[model samples]
Target: MDPRDWLARNTFHHSAFQDLRRLVAEKERQGLRLSLCIPTLNEEKTIGKEIMLLRAELVSRYPLFDEIAVIDSGSSDRTREVAAAFGADVYESADILPETGTRRGKGENLWKAIYQLAGDIIVYLDADIKNIRPHFAYGLVGPLIERPEVRYVKAFYDRPLAGAGGTRPSGGGRVTEILIRPLFSLFFPDLAALIQPLSGEYAVRRETLERLSFPIGYGVETAHLMDVYRAHGLEAFAQTDLDRRVHRNQSTGDLGRMAFGILQTFLSRLRPGGGAEALPELHAMLRQFQARDNAYELVEHHIVEEERPPMIDLPAYRQRRGLPP
Candidate 1:
């Protein structure tokens, strides 16, 4: 299908899913359980507020999700403590499955949540959003419950960069505009319709997520959009506009490292079968530069874009999900 056609059919606004009670009733009638996962790394300041709102509004009031969980990547603050206090089931990354080992990244937390969470459909929310609302969860869930064929629902937001004084109402998707969007325009045009391609808010069916390879780093979200598009085509995806998202901004240097990881994942998917005919192993370390007074200093960031195998391939996961072994 043409990219414009896909955008017209797939693009949606949060207001369209305004009836939370109706959405909840449909979810129950279909007998589909929902789970919410918040991946964290030292996000004490905002994790508390996010869980409080989600639990209070979605779980207690409306009963949209069966479980609200926090998969932490070794937080150094009160992120886990506060979330637990606010009634979120918090689990450390290492404790999920000790035998398989663990890695440190947002994607790792997400990948493990699949095994740990109990819902047939999973909704992932970023832990650092300062202006998080209930819509971030219910909006993404609405499309899946309303439309049976929609396997994945992504969130697009007016990402406002927060400053000391206040927020500016624009400028959050730097890497998406520069790297991911252009890459999509060149390679996967249909996926270019995704407004916030790398937005960390989305709800995905468990079957879709379990079948795709997960890049356990900055490249995870980008990899998911392309992977899902490859598996199910444009029809499998839908996006809902969440209006505004307020969050802290990263430096240009940090974004460069992220782009490097994303580029590695993007390139690996070029040729059929992970480009095995031409591509070799991708290097884990990412090299960058910094200026000290007058001289330029080289900095090496070990950005290992290690991927987790599909959850369906794991025996433990199958047992947890009660699938045939």
Candidate 2:
């Protein structure tokens, strides 16, 4: 399908899904179970509110979500405690698949959630959104529940950044605008239609999620878009407009590290089979300069975008899902 046609057909507004009763009825008619996963590092302040609003609105009042889980990355803060206090089922990421060992990244928590949560569809929301709302969950899942062909629904919104001057409107983010967009436009033009490819909020079908490999770092979102588009084309995806998303912004140096990881993943997908294993050994070090008291110092960060194989390939996941080995 043409990108414009796809955009016209697939792009949606969150308001289109505000009727929770209709959405819930459709979900029940389809016999679909929905799970919400909030991946956290240290988001104690916001995690509680996100869980509270989502659980109260989606779970308690509407029964749109079967479970609301916080898959924590062993936060030193009270993120898990706060989530649990608000009636969310909390699980430490490492504890879910102890046999495979632990890798500390948001993607790791997301990949493990597929194994830990019992739902036909899983919605992933970042733990750091200050403007927490139930629409963040239901809006993404509405497309999946209503349309069987849409295996993934990505969230796009007006990102408002707070500054000394005032609030300024922004597009996706620094890394997305500077790096990912150009890369996608060059190679994966169909994916460029997505307004916010790097947004941390999306809902994906369990079957589709399990079939794709995961990069356990900043590269995960980019990898998912490439793989899904490659496998199912742009028709398999839909995007929802969530209006505004408020959150903390990362500094340029941190974005540099993220960009480095994302670039590594993007280059690897260019090869035949589009697998990380096909690439030659590449350096994982991200070197940046820091100005310290009239002097420039080099700071090196080791950011290897290690990948986990498809969840369907894992024997443990298959056993848990009761699929034939």
Candidate 1: 10-residue stretch with minimal lDDT: 163-172
**Deviation (Å) of 205 in candidate 2:** 0.3
Candidate 2 segments exceeding 4 Å error? 159-170, 273-281
| Cα lDDT, all candidates | 0.89, 0.91
Return the TM-score for each candidate structure: 0.93, 0.94
Q: Give the TM-score of candidate 2.
A: 0.94
Q: For candidate 1, lDDT tens digit of each residue in 176-241?
A: 889998988888888888878888999999999899888998889988988898889999999988
Write down the lDDT that model 1 would get.
0.89
List model 2 lDDT by residue over 202-277, tens digit each: 9999999999999999999999999999889999999998878889989888899999999988887787654445
**What's the C-alpha lDDT at position 46 in model 1?**
96
